[model samples]
Target: MAKDYMPPSDFLRALIDEDVEIEADDTATIKRLLSFFKDPDAANRDWAVFLLGQSEVDTKAVRDALIGALNDEDDSVRAEALVALAQRDGDLARPHVLEALSAEGVYPTVFEAAALCAHPDLIKPLRGWLKATGDKEVDQMVAEAVAACEASAK
Candidate 1:
């Protein structure tokens, strides 16, 4: 989604307005965004989760919603949740980052989260992944994540 573009749905648009109004910390907006998690369209759910991730609210409701979103069917949504959670708290993001690293596929957002958290536990898996991926870009992402983890380890 474009930075300035809002979702075409009226409800989503209103939610965006409310997010802007309260700087994304309002209870009602958060509740509606949480409800949107159940939307049939993955895009809507993804967008809703993305908005929730951007929220400054640190309530248990928001954190639980982000953690729940890690199980979303869409990879991007899960990635966003991981990144958001990592940005907020390294301890909270560590296990999930390890799990994502152990997963079969290469997810760039997972690397992003790994880099953001820079926990020592991630270094081993990141080194194992180095140059193993056929995709150079992904390998580079792993390298950077490894570097971040190593720096933090030191």
Candidate 2:
């Protein structure tokens, strides 16, 4: 006899609840969560995509999906993707984050990306941005990233 499948909302929560127990076998669950990234409901898609990243399952598919989402039209989706990419590979995401920062009207996305970076080298570019644009928030965030990078280096 087969077990009954719960509805998606409940299922997702259940998956999260089971995260600790099944931590070692997240590959399959991550794939299943990735499928929801295309859901019509932006909230569902965003949450699913975010959860997939949190799984931290190292695989080509996960990396591709996160990279693709970094360009998502939705700002939150893009932010989540940037954060995931930062966790996966900070060096790889640096260029894209820097490009976004230089683009006008892209500060929010750029800021989110920079927050994820936590790399000291990002301080140079971020400092340049601060000097050029005089955006205090970005400057503060970059300062925090710099601190984090410095602490990690020690």
Candidate 3:
């Protein structure tokens, strides 16, 4: 039997609630999340992009929203948007990825995106990141991304 469904009155709280599972076809929830992009709080925008990117909701509107978020002032938001775009459409994300990878400090999530992208073009930047970020975890991630890009080239 299908259980009764009630949407949360507090979306932000619900966003972080472990017990609150977002349904795949929940357009209302998706719409509310999209609206969060314009929120003055950077954390709200960050959560919006991160959730949308991590979701299965694939739409042109979602993609465009993610793209727009790439320009967000918050680095985390931009990184989440880039990861979402990279996961959905590598071709559309390549230029932005290259630009982001060139930044003095690339976000960890962006490295995850690079791995997902697995584009040969990302190899040089990944190599650069491997040298630049002295952290062992980040180096491991960059190595994984480089391996992914290399594997894709074959």
Candidate 1, 1-154: lDDT as tens digits: 5577555556776666773443454677568778877777777877787777766767777778789888988887888889888888878999999998888885787888899999899999888889988888888888999999999988
Clashes found in each candidate (C-alpha, N, C closer than 3 A)? 0, 0, 0
Candidate 2 structure quality by residue, lDDT tens digits, 1-154: 0135232565465665674322436666666677766666666666666666676575778778888877777766776777777778878887777766666645444555676766665666665555444577656665666566556556
Assess each prediction's global lDDT (C-alpha) against the native. 0.80, 0.64, 0.83
Candidate 3, after superposition: displacement of residue 52 in Å? 1.4
Q: For model 3, how does the per-residue alpha-carbon lDDT over 1-154 read when each residue is reduced to its tens digit?
A: 0133222336755766645555668888888889998789877787777777778888888989989999999898899899999999988988898899888888888888888889999998889888577889888989999999999999
Itemize residue pairs with steric clashes in candidate 2: none
Best by TM-score: 3
Where does the lowest 10-residue lDDT sum fall in candidate 3? 1-10
Worst 10-residue lDDT window for candidate 1 reads 17-26
Off by over 4 Å in 1: 1-8, 13-25, 134-136
Which candidate do you rate higher for TM-score, 1 or 3? 3
- Of the two candidates 2 and 3, the one with more favorable TM-score, higher being better, is 3
Model 1: which residue pairs collide? none
